[model samples]
Target: MFFHPMDFLILIAFGISLWAQFRVKGTFNKWVEVPTRTGASGAEVARALLDRNGLSHIPIEVVRGTLSDHYDPIHGVVRLSEAVYYGRSISSISVAAHEIGHAIQHKEGYKALTLRHRMFPAVNIASGIAPFLLIGGFLFQALSLIGLGIIFFSVAVAFQLVTLPVEFNASSRARNLMIAEGFLYNDEENGVKKVLGAAALTYVAAALISLLELLKYVMIFMQGDDD
Candidate 1:
């Protein structure tokens, strides 16, 4: 009938993640529809920035989904969701700029982004196996399975750490570009900050959730041993 401390912590972490997701979603939605003063579409803003940086050859494509904007370095493409691609709102411009920031990082060979990209394949494989290892370990009372889980979770943690700098740098680049290029006026700068800041919280929440989940797995393994 007793539960480990990690069980409580995991539940708390899940709650926090859900709350943060909802809060950020609401904020994004509210701001994404507010029109920008310059009336430039998100796609237009992205093109202008890339062109200004001599990256006009990089393709910009509209992907389907909310908040799905990202740069595909391998394909040299910037993909934006319909909302972001067509919207002329300050939030849309900010999000679009943020994705372009990744492309800029790729073009400039930013160290953090390069490291994160190099780790992607390993991280993907580890993440794919992590749940299976952890759950199988708990179900079968196998130390080897538990060890595998720990190794996989450690890889995931490393990925999360690498992700922090890449994302923060992208947002920093987005904000600076917006100001330097006169995409945002003095009055609209705060709105751009708010949107990007809220977006960053989702990454923070994801990292925290992953860490707590790893702790739960560790606790489960220890309890199995004790039994």
Candidate 2:
């Protein structure tokens, strides 16, 4: 309820999560200064990739905010941030292509992405409910409530685990297609990798943090039960 031994590792993972966020922004800005050889804007790159994949029916929209780009599977649209939508830098193309990778995943019925979508609705509700359940259980010394919280929280953790492959697969698709479609040169591959890799670390850190906390809760629950 208060603190567990696993809290130490959770703190460490949380620190890594912060650093991963920082790394992604720094890497993006660093590569954003370096233009691609062809100097193609993100929107242009997205369109080319979409059309080449026979996904011309899907539309690209400019979304506001920094690094806010994503593919809307529900809407069947790709949204790019202003930086990725208009800039002609390596960061722009890499980010744009990554989102397009999600679009490709949607098109191909990637099992992980499909599972993530189906889990999202229930995970959303459970995630929101879990915190309150745990807090209230601790406050009232209710093992049943704690157990219920753990059950709900597990769903959220499972969702996070499922997300990892979806993200990695998207980055993999983006990198391969970026090279094959001539969006970036072979030499510039390092920059794309850095940008996408930094982004991937954030997800890894998040999943690690959640996993540690779930373990901590289970440990505490068992300790109390044994007592």
Candidate 3:
């Protein structure tokens, strides 16, 4: 079953995702040791950037879990993990800047960010039910059902695609702000870049995986229709 022709695409996507995760973790671990010259904790950096951008109304909160940091657009909060919230390391500050960049996007009504937010609801529904629809279609030889599954799953892929720009723009904003604000010294830029670049790869990997899954489903449906 695993040796199906279409499975090759999935295997490649899985390999890419694994490498992305490894790179992100390895890069973060390497830079986590390097303390920033500014000596600002992640929360501190997030607060300063947000306040300067007139986003002082947004709150910064510490959350549990490793690499679970994110901005809650609905709540207008930037949430960081324990290490990021307290540690004054390059990884910490870089991550903090990236999250705050998302807050800035929300404040400025970035088109991609706004589109992503709007897509979230439909994407959520499609993501949950699409798998079952596909499985049922395959088991029962229902081409129409399979097509429906593909249509639903495509929304999720679209969401992931839209997310790429939102994420990359956030990182760009983070890097630019950090440089202009002198949050990092000349020598510290490389470390921050490594950290943020690694983080961004995870998003790219996610989008790729989603796209591959959608392709796999389409291939399956097409093949079955031919038979």
Q: Which candidate wins on lDDT?
A: 2
Candidate 2: 10-residue stretch with minimal lDDT:
1-10
Please provide, for model 3 over 28-62, each residue's C-alpha lDDT reduced to its tens digit, 9 standing for 90 to 100.
Answer: 88888988888899999899999899999999999
Task: After superposing candidate 2 on the true structure, give the runs of residues whose Cα lies further than 4 Å from its correct spot.
Answer: none
Better of 1 and 2 by lDDT: 2
Q: Rank order by lDDT, top first? A: 2, 3, 1
Error of 1 at 145 (Å): 1.6
- Residue-by-residue lDDT tens digits, candidate 1, 11-81: 77788778878877888898887898989889999999999998989999999998888999999999999
lDDT of 2: 0.95
What ranges in model 3 sit over 4 Å off? 1-3
Better of 1 and 3 by lDDT: 3
Name the runs in model 1 displaced over 4 angstroms. Answer: 1-3, 219-227
lDDT of 2 by residue, 1-227 (tens): 59778989999999999999999999999999999999899999999999999999999999899999999999999999999999999999999999999999999999999999999999999999999999998999988888999999999999999999999999999999988998889899999999999999999999999999999989888988998
Candidate 1 colliding pairs: none
Which scores better on TM-score, 1 or 2? Answer: 2
